[model samples]
Target: MKRIKWVLGLSLVGVLAVSGTAYALGSGASGMMGQTPQFIRTQNQVGISKMGYGYGMMGNYASSNGAAGYGGNGGGCGGVNNGESYSMMGGPYNAASLGINLTDGQVTTDDQALSLAKAYVQVLNQDLSIDEIHEFNDSYEVELNESKTSNKAFEFLIYKNGGYISSEMGPNAMWNTQYGHMNGRNSGNPGKPTVTAEQASKTAQDYVNQQMGTGYSIEQPEVAPGYYEFMILKDGKDFAELDINGYAGQVWFENWHGPMIKTINNGSTTK
Candidate 1:
């Protein structure tokens, strides 16, 4: 139900790093590029089944129409629809082939989706790790490491047939949700924060002062996924709402939502 209103923009160089070698991903990335269609996993609760390239944990058969709507809007997050790397499998794959009719932006199971998404992240940036993943109406959205600012992080989506839909790199920069603070958002771990509510509040206050120049007030930073979304107030006047990277402390001021809005893939978030 919550929505992020910013774009995480990874530099062009960062995107091209993985985009150039679109096919070389996963376990056999190097050798399997032109040789054969990369096969996905068929696993169950116990673990990955010996049987290779098959259905996922959820019954392999379900009726889901392909409808994609992912990538939330938040300052510093970059997103692409129908991204490059069409399909991980070289060829011969469809919802029917896998015994399911998948709706875009939704996932039946996390492990099944992660098995497929992890490969993509690994190839793009070995240092990066999948921090979260969720099923949307028509696609699976995944976010990577929080080591840097949100704008500098890596995130992407995986299509039904195991194809790389789109990728987001380098979110602009914003404060992380300072959960637990008296004035913080309701949902978030308040303890051991990398950037505490006090820090974020100060960050907001400092930014507002610098931008507006004297006599600016703040309404407390609220947690939104990777960053905090809050408003800067100047005599009840809306100076701006800023989103800042919870860690790196990068920032930007932009919030324009289209017909469909997306947010962090914190289990419940969708596009």
Candidate 2:
């Protein structure tokens, strides 16, 4: 009986070796003998809705087996091992890496309106001393009426020596107007005489021309009774204008005034 048992054992060992060889050789029966009994059900099982690893069958197998949480579907984070991955939360790293240096008079096209406004403020501060300037933060509600032919005007106060002495808008200040009157007012009447708008315009133009050379010309004449508007025209075009108040009324010149004149001309040429 012992001999028979030993023969049976030897036979079993030989069969196992043959089966292993057959499996290695790609035999179906041999493969089945070599495979774990649980493999077909576990490895072939479908994973949860979404999950996978490293772009391979083994990863999918792992996912299906529920060994990998979330099945490595990558979801919103995109898929891992699905080529290059990027972070939505992390902004452009290169942009953050660069340092920005800002200084005065640094011209940039970005934020142009804001830059111009800042430049205007800078010019004011630089041209006028702290004692000669008073800044007020104010807001205006502008109502535009198409039927009314009126000038929508504003006044900016100018302080000198701690006193509010004058007001100006685009270089047409009260003091400038007064100076024009002192120099350009008709000598004929100190009490009761009429002065023409043309005469006032001529006077203002002559003053500007004399001071700034022949490059200036009158673009708009002051049309009001006592006020005169004169513009400095350059290259056959109006660059900046000034309004003069004759005794009481204000004069206005259109589109021919301020430091922006040169900048505007330069832009035109470039365009």
What TM-score number comes out for model 2? 0.28
- The alpha-carbon RMSD values of the candidates against the true structure, listed in the order shown, are 21.5, 41.8
Pairs in steric clash, model 2: 51-71, 52-71, 222-229, 239-256, 240-256, 240-257, 241-256, 241-257
Candidate 1 lDDT at 12 equals: 29
TM-score of 1: 0.31
lDDT of each: 0.38, 0.26
| Regions more than 4 Å wrong, model 2 | 1-147, 155-194, 222-226, 248-258, 262-271
Tens-place lDDT digits, model 1, residues 100-136: 4345633356555665565555444445556666444
Candidate 2 lDDT score at position 73: 18
Weakest 10 consecutive residues, lDDT, candidate 1? 16-25
Task: Tell me the TM-score of each prediction against the true structure.
Answer: 0.31, 0.28
